[model samples]
Target: MSVAAAWARCDERVVARQTLITFVGLRDPYAHDPHEDGRHKGPILTLLDERSFDRVILLGRPHRADHSERTRQALKELHPKLSVQVIGLELADATHHPEILAKLRVVLARIRRDGPDDEWSVSLISGTPEMHACWVLLAVAGELGAKLLNFRRTVHNGIAGPRFVRELGWGEPLASLRPETLALLSTRRDRWDDVDQQGAAHTPPRHYFSRAILELAVNLSRHLAPLLVKGEPGTQKHLFASLVHQFSNRASGPLLIFNCATVPADLFETVLLGEEGDGGDGKLRQADGGTLVLIKAQELPAPLLARLLKAVDDGHYFRARGRTPVKVNVRLILTTERDFEEEVRLGHLPVEIWRRLRTALITLPPLRERPGDVLRLAKDELERLNRTLPRPKRFSPAALAKLESHRWPSNVSELRRVIEHAVLTAEEPAIQPEDLDFELAVNLANVFTAAVPRLREGFSMMDYLRAMKLELVRGALRKTGGNQSKAARLLGLTPQAVSQILRQTEARE
Candidate 1:
């Protein structure tokens, strides 16, 4: 081939390579702008000498399209073996960080439609401060796999030129952050608040945790470390697990939930491992590149818990009929109602697993502890239920008063059930106190209050008291599921004492 033909072929290769997403700055189009340091050759012009890009994607305000065009023309005339493209980005205001970030995201999303994020490098030194900050944020968030670059004026021995900085990121600074400080910073970020909404993205969203634990959850989400959430039965542990998933780097991945208490013993292995013997797809595979939440994990046998902890420890698992080990990138989150420490003390939970998870533990506060959350949850639940209704219903002052005054012993779950039932069955448009049917708890004091009206004429005080004691003991035994020690604690007696009382009561019956 002739010299010109060979040169054209080489230029075509350079033009075909995709790279470099940047902005045309306010000072980017000028032939020469003087600074105290030296004569400015424009940011994009300086980048040419520092780095080689196949193409330059220039984003700027609509009025500033001329700047990008000027930069493109000058680069094409000056450099023969380069490719460049100009993208006119319309922004309401360059100084508005949120708007600039949003607009850039739209453009990048479209650009990525043609290719992946790794295809281009974003220039943090281009455009306005908002654009620069957005690029840094996107890089830190792992929104793209593309490398970052910046050109800055530098001097060595009084000789000045633009210096290239490669792969601009938060690595060094983030690594230097103390654990506590990192958690504090994570909590202050609004991402948690953004995902805290429960249903339909309503106002007064439900937070998965209280103040301290929320911070911890946010911090834990930044990495792939195992997480354990503890709470009572109705404390919304599943939603808490969702919070962890949404906040993680794997937010785009699947979130699979496995209920430890609901799965039958025979199916547990298959459900967890897909097919234990045949290499069938399991929950682990289904949840790969995302999160797998084990709900009510305390019900899992100690041996099984050991197996899970081992698998999560190294991100590797073995199916019974598998030829080799299966490796998956999954974030494991376990939600349990049992006080894990007590479970460990009783040998119900494996000591090894407990020791490993203790440092990663976070507890959800019960609804009773958060008095203000009761009304909010009730309203939120009501609104969710009313979505399908022709006319939306609001809480009446009297009904709201009753709800606020009552103690929500079962937490958010119980409130949800009550609100749902009321919405479905209530006759009036406005839910009233009478419309709500609280699941009245059976306690000694409450039982006594209810029994007062049932007393017979001339009922002896001593006999009444004796009968009440027996009833309380039996109730405790029933509530404890015939566990004498648990019943004894409820009745303020020793296990042996409880046994004696049970025997006496049986004989009398």
Candidate 2:
């Protein structure tokens, strides 16, 4: 019989007996919350309850069985007729074991033969890649005319969908899913798009130099395809890091970020590399198969840097004092304010490590060169801060003009702080010039002056404009210390525009 016809036959059998659902997981702490009430139960238990499945088989590593058993017991109590099975596999035996698949097939086959008198189905709940492999096995049984029920985690309402199944990719399987399944997936995707749109909409105003910094970020992200950015204080390196993460191939992966500066230097290595005991594998291991963003990497000790560099080069980490080295395929994106190239040149950084990262350099521009961005940033920040504060507020035209005219030595971060401060301190709906931190305003006014005329005769206005633009660009480039996106935002231009301008300038030169 055809796969669809077979699935239809199996569906009739499934509705007759108590349906069985299986959960596959690798000991995650987040999954350990007690499910005594079963109201706010774990994903597996929740899926079973929602589908009204008669049985649930919880499978996980032996180390995690203690926690899994608690959940299993909760499921039994919640649905008195529901049967619960708990299976534990050795950590080493998980990925390569054929028995796991065999046991899973046996469970599904049994459920197919003895249909529950009431409505029932079986589902496998798994978030880990290894556990996800079970889908292939289930799909095979499904092909053999055994009824298969699949449940995917939903970001909203946390409910499972009941749908008839066929071959995994024989046709467009996702398209054939129940309306509820499609709706949940659509909602999750829309939520992601909304975040991206919100971030893009908040793009700050650009000054002359901002474009250059953005260019640097775009170039580094494109050429290197993946990179680690390190720069000095007030350089907006983190902003560039965010841009890179947003634009890279692994953008879909969780953007796990940790600042080395905020974390004590003594614990920096442990935090970045991760620890062994207490289910903590450190940052490098946890971020395995995803992107591990280390902000303020300059603060890390030389030894920790060496370990990280080794992991980056080898694509796996040799945990300190741990057993076997865990193989982790991860993209390392480190950001720092320190001039690592200089450090490498001065022999502070090893030559091998420098060689691996030489091509991925991205410097961020400081705030001073991108004066135009100041007003825009102020506006955006004020708008955001207004949402939190008691009343709506706006920067007066004169205040905005004053902001644009003054140099921002502290860059975007400083600008954000100033706006937040002004919002907090302002008495009225309008932010007057006096409301702004006068000290910052005075400091900025003294820093920037009108462009001095070039002594070289026959300098065209176009040439002057070009020169001025380049100067601002270069300054912003230096200020971001060389993150391109922040520079672009600082310049009120797109990262792509900044890169094009730079390329054109380079060609002309």
Candidate 3:
């Protein structure tokens, strides 16, 4: 489905009994409020009497079975022949968000199994805020093609009546949800408040260069055929893709991510290009009118890369069994840790896809390159950990110095873990250098093992040792920012000894 066609879908109202599936929320047993009486009574009466629904499914906490039964009996009094299904959740408290979402999933799964053909509608009037949020998420995800039925008492009649909101069906994304609901579900509530009628994009990272890269990505993400993002594994490749998706015109559409490294080649092809008897839509169709993030994109086999290239160029592709090509309006954000030039040279990446990726190529510098951001990100992570831990702790001068000086091979991900561990184990008030749990010795050992292999297999052991020493000296110099004294200190040797070793190594080279 094309993006424009999906957005142009008109609101629908289902009236028939067999086609109608109503999920009504049961009233809280303890609540005794007059103004909120429309919570249960209004939506039920409207659906049963006005809409003529075939079945009204009542959902509530397991401990409140009596409340659900009482509501069912009362509804029966109004329409005795009306089918009522009362379902009690195992949860004692439905107020928590995770619990509500988990229970809702079970309810949704059962509905799909029992009545696959029924058109469903949900009442958000009576459940807890968590329940309402969960229902909204399900609807927004298009996992449930359920219409949201709303009811509020009119001032003129002073009685609740059927109010048609909007229907959530296949192809509809989260942007179709009511603005208020979007605001409530969004974690960046502060940013949400600043947005205009058309929801605004997320703010980019704090770094100046990152912000510039994000600006470029946002522009390219909207209209480009296929954008390529190049970075190391922990260099925020996926994070940048999300930012690009959020800031683009397709922000309203779904952002489906698939890691080429994780998915098997055959299964991935099935997910990307649906087969004739697949019985369901492929991820390409599922991500229509949105963005698709392909992680480790360089790992894609040659044939699959060609297929994706064709899809991007033509804006359509044939499904497994379907003869006719299905038009798709999805933005592609391909991320890879491998070098694009090297891949092209090795024929790992097809020429056509490589050309398509030329539309936009974003390279994210490693965290070590952005040295200024380290302390800021570390402190921010510390603040985040403080909220969950027993006590807040600040980094000591020595600890902070070590953090700044260390060569973070895994980039931001490694730094985050280090900070999390330090926050958890450090004493109150201040985190000392010892609080930071690092395995430098283990890393050195691994480096040595990797640098010298087959030493016992007729290779010269002294030559291997000399080569390792030379590499270590060069690495130390690079890490210490060309400071000989600092490099010597890092290698646990005197500056004069380091100078002599360097001179000897240079002469040998």
Candidate 4:
């Protein structure tokens, strides 16, 4: 049935017996002066007149105690049999969005404890935009199971709204959490940007993709689907798996991690599935009501893979060396070092296992593919490593260039190692190019030499020569650890000229 149709058929008799909880905005368009003593026809009053509520709880700022008390008295006078109470909400300013969100969460928690047997509805029309936003977030996050009330110009009973009752519109769990994540990040957006400005200018888009992956993680967490995370080793598949567990509603449950590649092939099955005569629970049994994370899933033997497929498909499996079936519930999160699809096609991995486990798939791109992330991640890692040092350190301009240039073969793990080494060994406050140690060199100079003239319109021979000279200067600075004196010495020019060239480069940037 359509959502509107479902709400339209709501049992009115049942809702009448419940308490009506709502926020009272500081400004009420329809409210009358208290001393004037005319019947107040505000939205809250309108709602009270139409619906038979058992009691009404009005939440607002403590400073508005008089306004709330008058509202409570008016409510009691209109419906003498009705119970009414006024509660003060701390920090009701719209600019304090996080605190307001926290207050809303607290209110919902109290409602959860006190109104389990009562039908509930929340009004979205009475508060500030920020409060409305918080209310919608709560409803969308499935934290507020209350029916939502809104005002419409046209009345359904010639009285108001087939009142826009809210339906949980966020389709996947990830979709719901995406807004919450954005909200959290939104609160501290300026702080993160300041971190970049104070030290190294970070590539902002790099973190955006991480947020996108978090959206996918939220969806994966809702089911018992066998998740297959495919990425190069050290691309953070394991960390992503942990995030999946952290964001999941099952976060309170256990997370059992076992590396398939580390276990002996003969002991793999027994270790994962557990033997009946074992002293304690095996990996599978231990992970019950929680998550089981398998690292290097590509290394599982064919027999063990077959047994895993059976257990996953049937939701029950017989213990090794025993016939008794053991029922289990585990959200399987698997990380693989190889392309899972290609392995299945080559018959290295069983198709049944692949088909069963492919319910949710997340592929993390290698560091080379996401070059923009290099410096941002490097800066963060460097900052973390410098915390224990005698003094915090930073990277030189040339060293930052080299950090961005080198194609990290081991992804973030390699980056962390390099940063740690630089922090510990460098004598200067700023790490120089010579302080970095990585093998892979991507020669942007050669590429720029061949392409700059062709890529730029109306280019001349002199422009090409200037570009070449610029590349040479950069190469010299990189070699000399960003020391202008050394670069000028290598190029047979004054240090002033090299400094001028570097200034021009910064201006263009």
Q: Among these predicted structures, which one has the highest TM-score?
A: 4
lDDT of each: 0.67, 0.55, 0.64, 0.66
Clashing pairs in 1: 274-282
Q: Residue 214 deviation, candidate 2, in Å?
A: 5.8
| lDDT: worst 10-residue window of model 1 | 191-200
- Model 2 agreement with the true structure over 79-187: per-residue lDDT tens digits: 7787776766444555442555665566555654654353434343343333334443444335323344443221211222222222123124343443322222222
Total clashing pairs for each candidate: 1, 34, 3, 1
Candidate 4 lDDT, tens digit per residue, 344-403?
889887777777777678888888888877887888677545544568999999999998
Which sections of candidate 3 miss by over 4 Å?
Answer: 1-209, 440-509
Stretches off by above 4 angstroms in model 4 are 1-177, 183-209, 439-509
TM-score of 2: 0.45
Model 1 C-alpha lDDT per residue in residues 1-509, reported as the tens digit of each score: 99999999998766545588888876675435466666566667766767777677777677877787878888888777776767778777876667776887788888887655336777765565556656655655567556767543332222332354545444444544444434333322322112223221211223434545555556888877678899876787887777666656676577777778778776766777665555477787788888889888877777767766677777888765565687877888899888989988887776788888887888888888888767877876776556546777778899999888877777776676566556654568999887676752323435633635466789798767667777777876665567776566545566888788778778878
Report the number of the highest-lDDT candidate: 1
* Pick by TM-score: 3 or 4, better one: 4
Q: What would you estimate as the lDDT of candidate 4?
A: 0.66
For candidate 4, the per-residue lDDT at 264 reads 80
Question: How many clashing residue pairs, candidate 1?
Answer: 1
